[model samples]
Target chain A: MSVRQTATAVRGRYQPRISLWWWLTKPSYLLFVLRELSSVFIAWFIVFLLLFVRAVYQGEGQYERFLDFAANPFVVFVNLVALAFVLLHTVTWFVLTPQALPLHLRGRRVPGGLIIASQYVGWLVVSAFVFWLVVGW
Target chain B: MRRRRPVEPLVWLLFSGGGVVTAILVPVLLVLLGLAFPLGWIDPPPYEHIHAVLGHWIARIVLLGLCVLGFVHWAHRFRYTLHEGLKLQRLDAQISLLCYGLALIGSVWAVYILLFTG
Candidate 1:
């Protein structure tokens, strides 16, 4: 074959295209995609938290303004949606933790279910601590 | 030029650590600070109380860690989501640059707010 034709043939080799909606084919796949998408909301929450911190740093007036902005219906709705997505992220992260990082106990691998349950226990403890901290000593 | 170390390991480290940290800490934080206080589901804490917690250096460090790891995790995950999931592999270089660049910028802003603003 001519050099140009050979180069063209090599470039024409089959390359499968993944559809954007491919994750929708299965419940688990969709959940995985949703988990990935949750990063956006996670980033949003971080930005929002920083803004709130800045407002607090500036003074009561700025903090009040931040609160007023946060209380807007559109902002509230978006945050509610973000909360749901973030919860999904949290649950899925814990459920998959064992698969990602398995534990061992004295020459035997720990049970995946046990590892998952331990994550929940840890989550509960941390959540409780945060609650206590926020609400006061 | 000095020898360069591969960054993939660091990226994965931050991603895993951020995943665990955010999973445990973020939900309740969002509920209380993002939703509850704003929506009046609970009374807002007094400004002095909020300020005192933030003024503490430990809290500032923890928050800085959270923001740095969180943004790095988002950058890594979103880069893959766009490259593989959405079939944008041809734009991989630009995507990586954009993702990690924005993450770096966010981390810097977080540091400024958490550390310098006080």
Candidate 2:
């Protein structure tokens, strides 16, 4: 047999089939899949934010309509679910940060806990600043 | 066989940068806009104030960057999810083009809205 024919035979003999329910087989795989799925909701939130900004820029009446739409029970529910996914994304991202960015201090690698703690602190500081700006101290 | 390009590095770079940005900002935005404001845990900012803030060039630029990077992040992740979860390796080129193409379109649309819209 020619090389092309042999290659074709080998490919035909050993094609691996993936199960549709493969993600359901393991808890960690399920979580990873969920983390990836969270990006859709994150994108939705960004789209909503952009729309809200546009409405605010349009003027008071438009902004009021945007608020009413946002305050609708279904919208609020969707946002709530998106919030949960975003929180998951945030936590998983923070936990993975140490691996993504390995830092060293005094020639010793920084611990993962320290990296995560710093992220939480940074989050608190930024959240506080935004809160102060919007709500006033 | 199709020639392979060195695009993975660039995509991974955007993915990491977007991840960092999303991690730092998404939670804060969610808490304020998603939960606190809606639940009245905190009084939402007035519309005029929001308008004023978004009117600033800096705010517009920041938002544009966030939206663009966020979409890029989604594109990369979803591409992999389709490849692995759906076992679509046979259609890798088509999937890659579709996913990244949409992200590019979204980023451009976001920029246009931010620049042209009120």
Candidate 3:
């Protein structure tokens, strides 16, 4: 029960647990966990998408109802969650992307950092274009 | 220690590339369609015109390839990270199989949507 002994014991018995407290307090940890929670957003989006499909099969009134359901504050909160999910998803996805997409053009070792940065840059350009269109056009 | 072939790493690369490309291409195309379609600044040419941008054969192949690869990437990375990083266990294989399985099914579904629907 001494401190070192306790540390050893905890490490020895580590049981597939990440600290809930740590996850709560740690910004990146919470972000990563929140990214995982993004499945909720995915599910909500899909359910509504399914509703749209159903409405298409049904008629305009059902589609309007679908729109109505979509406009609720709860739905807006859900979208906000989805946006946060996407942010975490994108950043983490790119950061880890190094492990996934190790492409090389001339037998050079492509740095993961470069890959991730490029991906984000590409996203930024595309997003800027979208913003430009949304605002200007 | 034996240096095992880095199969997982290579697979990760494919996953990353596909994910990145799709991640970039999709939103841009969508936005362009949204803005340009309405204002006549950016128009998606006729399906016939646009379809050939990615040749018929290439488009289908790439789409299926991307869908399958991206999901597999998600599966392998997520499972391994959960197991090693967060120290989660007991469900690694289950999660991996489930995610990858969805990817496979999704690939087939996408193929059907593209080829048969069109």
Candidate 4:
């Protein structure tokens, strides 16, 4: 066999083309892709938050303008969608946490459900505190 | 050929830490800043109040940490997505550099803005 033929054979054996729609084959895979995509929106939220902080640091006028921009219908819609995606990301993170951080209590393994539930409880407590700071203050 | 150290475990550690930060903090932030404030479900706080809350050193640190780790988390996930989903292992070096480089730059900018925006 020619060297060229051998090289072609080796390349063909080593590199199989992956399909573009590979993620669509399974719901879990699709969900994983979406969760990964959610980070973009989460990053967007962080940018917006940073802008808010900068505006606040500037003065009341800048802060008001930032609030107005945030309240615009288009911005609100984008934020709403981003919120959903981020929530999905958060839920998946919690669901996977028990596997990531396996804990043993009294020599037995802890249940995943309890770990996830505890995260939810912590979320609630933090949210309630923030809610108070925002509205109840 | 030179040998390379396995970096998967280090990347996984960052991914896990970022996941924990996002899970604990992102939802409440969304509910408060994204939904309630705009939807009128709750009265928005005054600018002075919001500013005061953020002026605290601890709040600034938390925000910086969240943004940095969140970006790192993103870089690691998207790196694997490009590698496995798109079969870009041939471009692995370039892809890793771009993804993690962006994360590092973003984290630095976030910290700078958070610290010096006053």
Q: What is the TM-score of each candidate against the true structure?
A: 0.91, 0.90, 0.52, 0.88
Best by DockQ: 2
Question: Pick by lDDT: which candidate is best?
Answer: 1
Q: Each model's C-alpha lDDT?
A: 0.86, 0.83, 0.53, 0.81
Ranking of models by lDDT: 1, 2, 4, 3
DockQ for candidate 1, please give it. Answer: 0.52
Per-residue error for A115 in candidate 3, Å, reads 6.7
iRMSD per prediction, in order? 4.7, 3.0, 8.6, 3.6
Question: Candidate 2 on B7-113: residue-level lDDT in tens?
Answer: 88888988888887887787778777767777778777877677777788987888888899999999999998998788776788999999899899989888987
- For candidate 3, write residues A1-137 as lDDT tens digits: 55433544566565343463566777877776676654334333333433433443344565456545655767656565565554555666678677855778799979877888887888898778644533343
Off by over 4 Å in 4: A1-10, B1-8
Off by over 4 Å in 3: A1-21, A36-80, A92-121, A124-137, B1-7, B26-62, B77-88
Q: Number of backbone collisions per candidate, in order?
A: 0, 0, 5, 0
Kindly report which residue stretches of model 2 are placed more than 4 angstroms away from their true locations once superposed. Answer: A1-10, B1-4
Docking quality class, candidate 1 = medium
User: DockQ of candidates 1 onward, in order?
Assistant: 0.52, 0.57, 0.12, 0.52
Across B51-102, the per-residue lDDT of candidate 1 in tens digits comes to 8887889888988888989898899889988976887756878999999999
- Residues B50-96 of candidate 4 have per-residue lDDT tens digits of 87888888888988888888888888888878877786766878998
Every candidate's TM-score, chain A alone: 0.85, 0.89, 0.64, 0.87
